[model samples]
Target chain A: MLEAFVFATILFGFFGIILKKNLMMKIIAMDVMSTGVIAYYVLVASRGGFFTPIFSGETVAYADPVPQAVILTAIVIGFSIQALMLVGVMKLSRDNPTLETSEIEKNNTP
Target chain B: MNQITIVWIALPLFLGFSGYLLPKLDRYFVLGMALLSIAYGLQRYVAADTLTLELIDSFGVTLVVDSLSSLFILANAIVTAAVVIYSWQTGKSAFFYTQAIILHGSVNAAFICADFMSLYVALEVIGIAAFLLIAYPRSDRSIWVGLRYLFVSNTAMLFYLIGAVLVYQANHSFAYAGLSQAPMDAIVLIFLGLLTKSGVFVSGMWLPLTHSEAETPVSALLSGVVVKASIFPLARLALMTDDLGLILAVFSIGSAFLGVSYAIFETDSKRMLALSTISQIGFVLAVPAASGFYALTHGLAKAALFLIAGNLPSRNLRELRQTPIALPLWILLVLASLSVAGFPLLAGFGAKTLTLAGMAPWQEAVMNVATVGTAIVFAKFIFLPFSAQPEAKEGKKYTVGFWIAVLILVGGLVAANGIYMDAYTVDSLLKALIKIGIGWLIYFLIVQRFILKLPRGMEQFDQLIGVMSLMLVLLFGMMLT
Candidate 1:
């Protein structure tokens, strides 16, 4: 059930990206999609138990922490990409004064 | 020797960062490091053994250097040096040098990294550097194009990350060597992402616009080496699985024909060259053999061509007639074009002959058709620059880089077709000559007499997204059946 929900969120992100004409909406969609991926990884990492992965005599059923660690790196990478994309959008808008898909497409043709 | 792994990655980054700190010495720093990187890469090539540098085993990030990786890094290092040399004459600011250096380091890192996480990080670094570099000139169109490239690239990376997760879920490991038991679905997912990055047809439709719109030096590197970095990993993955080769071969033929066909109708010089890159990369991706030779030769030729195109007054082919250029520059451009056209005795011919010897008859036929098409398109590019004007002086750096690339092409031709200096059989030479003749005839007869109009829909940004998604589905279906 949780997998289905995460998949749905990812799909929602894709739809938002593809369907929206606004550049800001597209960036938001990207963040949503990345978040969905992170959530899935976190869920996978916690499958064994809710306990932290740190070694301790008291906690025997610790979930896998590797996924959590990897996902953290992924999150940082995703955030930077998003930041760069936003900066690009800002610069693009400053030049054309409009963020409409049609305007951007028309401007793209050389 | 083991330290060579870290040095190849670190030296460039250090030099690039230091260049920022000392802006006056930026160009010299970048150029010196580029030469140093090449020398180190060559040293590794001479040794030619796999060196693994374990950074953090728990994180599964390690750098591995094999002969294949060594060759790739060497080629990348050489072309990057040329790019740095070319950039010197332009009087580009410190930021350009910094970005170019970062790009060089990341590309080298991508070639040598042994695990998925490091590979992922390398790709992202490349993405960031490439995006900023593409938008460096900051024209409205360049920025939009760069944004499109960034978005597509990010989406592709996400798909790749998800694939990595799937593999990890199944096998509990993230190392490339540990993917033997990985599910077919996982493999397919990974390849789908790679397809997007490889600049294949449908998936990588945004490639031409992005490549053509970037600054001249950046375009040269983009066309020459950056795209190949993505494909190197795909090639490595294909070695581990049988299904990827067959699938790759089919897509390769499609991209080859499609790219050349688009080049035929394209009016802009850089865009035409960009399209041809797609076509040639199709050949690179077609077979499972070490495509490093072809990639290296193509990088040299394409970089020189893009730089030549940069010198032209305008990008239109017709403009070449009015503009005056040096005789030696013209000669260099001609050799580069012939190399791209797969003319006999050139590096392109050597790679084509070797790759063709291994393919099935029908696939060979399709590739031949693509070659003829390549000849037709490049004939226009080469003949356009010919003028009777006196020699005009070009920058020393530009000329030097061009000659180096031309020499490398010749050297590679010798290396690729070793023994028997005239390696092309009389029959094969005759066949190649006939193909070029026929292509030229068709170009004048049909292309000029009755123009072939292809819709520019594929070049549009949204349409490319639609095609990429559709092609992913088609690829999945192909894998199933």
Candidate 2:
């Protein structure tokens, strides 16, 4: 059930990216999609158990540490990419001001 | 001794970050790194031992240097050296050298890494470096192009990450050997992501625009080596599954035709070269055994052509006719163009022959047709008038970088004689001539007749995302059967 919901979040983000004409909206949609993927990784990590991965003399099950570690790196990468995209968007807005995909395309073509 | 492969990845990265502080010597730093990498690659190739270094034993992150990867490392080194030399005359910013050096390291890392997790990190590093390089011009237009490239590339990589997670869920390992236990859906997702990165078919539609818009040396790097980065992984995947290989064959052939058709109609010289890169890469992907060789030859020749294109007064095909090139540069252009067109005695012919050897009969026929199309596309450049123009003396001054790049390419062509000796057969030569003849005839007949235009909407960002999603669904459906 949780997997289905996570997938829905991903699909929703994709739809937003595909349907949104504004460049800023598209960037946001991309972020949402990345967040959904990260959530999916978290869910995967949780398959081992719900408890914290750090062992402290507890008998309860602990989540998989590998996926958590992997996703941590992925999260850093994702954040940096998002920052770069936003910076690009800020630069782009200076010239066209509207930041509409159509207007940018018009200016791009010869 | 086995751990030496790590230095290939480490040295450039160290230089890339540290070179920034020493801005005046950044170019020399990059040049030294490139030369050192080439020396290391040569030493490894001559030793001919497959070296592997385990980073974290449990995590399966390994660095490997085999014959195939060593060749790529060598190619990357040579191209990096040539690009650095070329950029010297262009007077590029210190930032460009930093990114180029970092890109060299990341590309080498991508080739050397042995598992999915490490490969992902390396690819992301490459993406970031390439993004910075593309946007180095700092124009409104380049920023937008770089942004689109990053967004689409990251989205595709996220899908790849999800696929890697799926593989881990099933197999409990990220190594290529563990792929045998991977689910079909996971493989399909990985395939789609790599397809987009390699600029194959619908998924890679961003390539032509992004490659053409960048500065000349950056375009050379993008088309020459960066685009081939994903193919290394895809080739590994294809080797593990016959189904994936079949799928690769289909998409590669499609990409070949699509790229050539676009190139045949393109008026912009750089855009035409960018499109031809898509097509030539198709040849590389078509045959796994020949991929390394084909990629090396194409990388050298294409980088030379792009460096030469940098010297042109106008990029438009019609405008180029009014200006005649100098004799020496004209010869260099002819050699590079013919080599790319797979002329006998040049490097591309041997690579093309090897690629053709692995294809089924029908696919071979299609490849031959695409070969002719490639000829037609380059014929536009080959037949340019070489007569002296009044402004040619002042308008065109060949720089030191230009000569250096051409020399590297020429030397590469000369060295390729050993590899292509077996491909020199009467029947193969005859077939190559016939293809070129047909292509030349077609070019002459339709020189001014056809004006083809692909849909503008297809290249738009939203449409690209839509196309990628649709391809995912389609590939998943195919995998079910």
Candidate 3:
């Protein structure tokens, strides 16, 4: 049930990307989508248990370290891509101050 | 010696990043690295055994250098070298060389990496570098194109990541060998992501726009080699399942017809070339066994053509017809264009034969029809007149890079196909001639009567996402049955 909800979150973000006319909203939606993916990985990692990955000298189930490690790398990559997109948005705004998709499209058409 | 596999990816990356410090010498450094990569790739191609390098054993991160990847490595190296050479006279900024060289390394890594995690990382690096390259001009339009490319590609990759994670959850391994045990849904999602990246069907609609809008050499790289990044892994996955292979085959045929139909009516010369890329890439996807050879042939030929397009005075076909081209450049254009149209004795002919050898009769027939369409599209180039202008001396420096690219293309054809003896038989020659003749006749007799435009707004940003989601649902439906 929780996994289904996570998928909904992803779908909601994706719809935002598809439906939003504002470029900034689309970027935010992209972030929302990626965050949802990251959340899904987190949920998967904690499926075993929520205990620390390090040894605690007790008999306890620890969360999967692999997904966490992988998601860390993913987070960094996602951050970088978002930064690049933001930079592009700023640059694009120079020509079309509104930053609306329709306006940008009109400007782009030769 | 297997450890040397890392060098193939790392050298360019190291040089590219460090290039910021020595902006003046960066181009030369990248050029030398590209040449070294080609030489090393040749050495690996000649050797018989597959080499595997284990980078992180616990994570299953390994680089596999096999016959299949060696061909891609060679193609990537050659195209990089050609792009670097072609950009010489254009005087691109240091950042351009940096991104180009980085893209080269990441592409090589994507081809050789074995596990999903490493592959994802490599692909992300490739995407970053490609985005920067596309936006290199800093113009508003180029930035918009780059952003759209990034958005679409990133969304597709997120799907891929989810699929990768699902596979891991099922099999407890992220390696390609572990994919056989993955669930159907995971495989479908993965295939969808890869197909998008490879510029197949609806998801690939961004290709023509992105490829046509970038700088000339960048356009050559994107069309010629960058799109092949996902195809290597996609082919590997298809090899594991018959259902997936059949699905891919259907899409490949569809992409071929769609691309050529677009190319047949496109008036912009560069845009036509971009559409033809989508068509030729379909041939690569159709026959996974021969994909490497087909990609190499198409990559070299397409790169040469784009380099030639850079030298042309105008992007419009009508304008091109009015302006005469230098004799030497015109010859090069004809040779490269003919090779892409699958003329006898060229690299594309041999690649096409290999691709068709394993296809069903109906698929083969459809592919042949697409071949005629391809010939018709390129016939526009063949009909162009040679230089009648006395002032051709003004831009002679530009032809230097064109000569270098065309020479490498011809050299690649000879080296790879070795005269293509089997493809040169009378029956095949006659078939090729007939196709070319019919294509030209159609161009001269029928196609000149109309000016057709692709329905507007299909390739826009929002529509792209909508189409992608529709494709995901469609793929799910197809896979379920």
Among these predicted structures, which one has the highest lDDT? 3
lDDT of 2 by residue, B391-430 (tens): 5455567788779877897688658756658888999888
Worst 10 residues of 3 chain B by lDDT: B388-397
| Candidate 2 collision pairs | none
Q: How far off is residue B413 in model 1, in Å?
A: 6.7
DockQ comparison, 2 vs 3, better candidate: 2
Clashing pairs for predicted structure model 3, backbone only: none
TM-score of each: 0.93, 0.97, 0.97
Off by over 4 Å in 1: B54-56, B321-325, B390-423
Ranking by DockQ: 2, 3, 1
Give the per-residue lDDT digits (tens) of candidate 2, residues A25-86. Answer: 98889888888899998999899799987778868888888888998999999999989888
Model 3 CA deviation exceeding 4 Å by range:
B388-399, B419-421
What's the i-RMS of each model?
A: 1.3, 0.9, 0.9
| lDDT: worst 10-residue window of model 1 chain B | B412-421
Ten consecutive residues with minimal summed lDDT in candidate 2 chain B?
Answer: B387-396
lDDT by residue (B1-481, candidate 1, tens digit) is: 7765566578888888998899999888877877887787777778877788886555556677877776677668777877777666567889988988899889888888877878888888888899989988887787788888888888777778877877787767787765657776666667777778778877878898889889888889898889988888877777766667788889889989889989988778899899999998898887756476667667777887887788666687756656666666677677778877878777777767766766778889989999899889888766664556655545423456545544554454435444123538887788788888888888878764544567777777667656656866887788788
